[model samples]
Target: MYKLLFAGLASFVLAGCSDQSWRTTDIGDIMPPLDFTLTNEEGETVHGEDYRGKATLVYFGYTFCPDVCPITLSRLGDTIRDLDDETRDNIQVLFISVDPSRDTPEVLKRYTDAFGPEFIGLSGEQAEIDAVTNRYRIAYEYGEENENGDYLVTHSSAVFAFDREGQAQFLMRDSHPVSDAEADIKRLASQGG
Candidate 1:
């Protein structure tokens, strides 16, 4: 599953190579427009339309992830920090927990707060999560639980970027540099759609 995700991303990147304007893979045509309904950190139901006027980045992972989750969010925080105040305010990072069984709204709030004010955590019932993941072609699965009832979730690490109008724009892989992300986000913010 992971390999399939990687291959898809690679093809997207390669297809975008002819366009030198974007720093990351241009997915404006291939990816779907942003759409989902999930519970926010404040335990309120929110839809993707609520974020319509901002350049949004959505990442699927779990709060309990040992390494990748924290590092990815932290790097995103860094990317936002590098932007000017106005551009920073115009961007949002949505952290969607794939492991909703253990990540309640309160837990998600706490986990995302450490990243930055621009970061918001969201989760929902399994079906809602599955809908969003499937819409984006993201693949995630759980590992076998240990005696302690702890398990790991293996999920795609790509970050989906959407323009201010909720249009699909680009995709960022883990290998994409923060500098590139920052630039791409700034461009998205300026475009206002």
Candidate 2:
């Protein structure tokens, strides 16, 4: 199962994303303008609408994820660091945990803060999480637990970007260069929300 998830992630990430510019086309083929209400790392209620008027990067993964999650997040952090202050401030990264049972608000907050202060971690009741994931077509399932109660979650690995207008714009994969992400984010920041 883990292998299958990784294979899918690799395929998604490798899907011909050579263009460094923000894509305004073909967004209608998938759901656009994502919205959700969940608790942030601070344990406060946060609405997806709050991220409007800024370029937002939304990723789904748990703190316990061993490989793909951290690698992609680190790239995102580095990409943000490469941007100018004005552009950086205009961008927001949202880390939404699929494993809500183990990923409490505080835990989510602490995990995301390691990447950057600009990153916001979110998780909520199972029902709320289900709704968000289903709407976004994010495939995730919990793996069998080990004796220590540790388990792995197999989930889609892709970074989605929302323009300042709150419209879903583009997606970047793990294979994409951080510089390309920076360029795309800067382009999104320049657009009117």
Candidate 3:
């Protein structure tokens, strides 16, 4: 069929890709490494490099994100549960706090633990948080208090998937279902451990 012929031609061209297509790939391309070190709930330092050699599900939001963070985290836990044990071991779930000003390690731990232990919660100082957020192109705005000094932060809701060696691969929007994420993980895991 015409479609099959076109696909074969596309594969042939991809095999000899040139300067024009250097940054694109059908399976997704490698993005810059995120070199950051933050303190986990256990008061231990964790670096981006420590998660190399496995697919990592990364999300940038606060524990206080009423709708987005909790849903996304829950979906991630569910997606992980749906995976086979080996795939689960090869992947890590990270919940990075955008509200470093208020999200302490304990708070993060508590909020994330309610979902699953496999989820790691990280928080740091303002500068450290800014650096990581910028590297991932995540936007967050906080401040302004209510009568009771309660505050709210508005941020982007996205689930970014990274391959081994710390390169970005895909991003799941707030509307993307857990099934979409599961398919992605299964495909990546198929490439071998």
Q: Which candidate is the best by TM-score?
A: 1
lDDT digits (tens) for residues 1-193 of candidate 2: 9999999988777674644335323353476686998888777888888878788888999999999999889988987887788778888899999999999988887898899987989999888899888878898999999999999999988888887767777777666666666677678766654
| Model 2: CA > 4 A from native | 1-29, 175-179
Candidate 2 vs candidate 3: the lDDT winner is 2
RMSD of 2: 11.4
Tens-digit lDDT string for candidate 1 (79-102): 788888888889999999999999
Ranking by TM-score: 1, 2, 3
Which scores greater on TM-score, model 1 or model 2? 1
Task: Assess the local accuracy of residue 86 in candidate 3 as a C-alpha lDDT between 0 and 100.
Answer: 79
> Between which residue pairs do clashes occur in model 1?
none
Report the Cα lDDT for candidate 2: 0.82
Reference-based TM-score of each model: 0.87, 0.83, 0.81
lDDT of each: 0.90, 0.82, 0.76
Residues 1-193 of candidate 3: C-alpha lDDT, one tens digit per residue: 9999999999889777742221212224544665688888886888889878887778888887778788778887887787788777778778889888678888988898888767889988888888888877788888699998778898887777777767776777755555655677666544455
Question: Which regions of candidate 3 are displaced past 4 Å?
Answer: 1-30
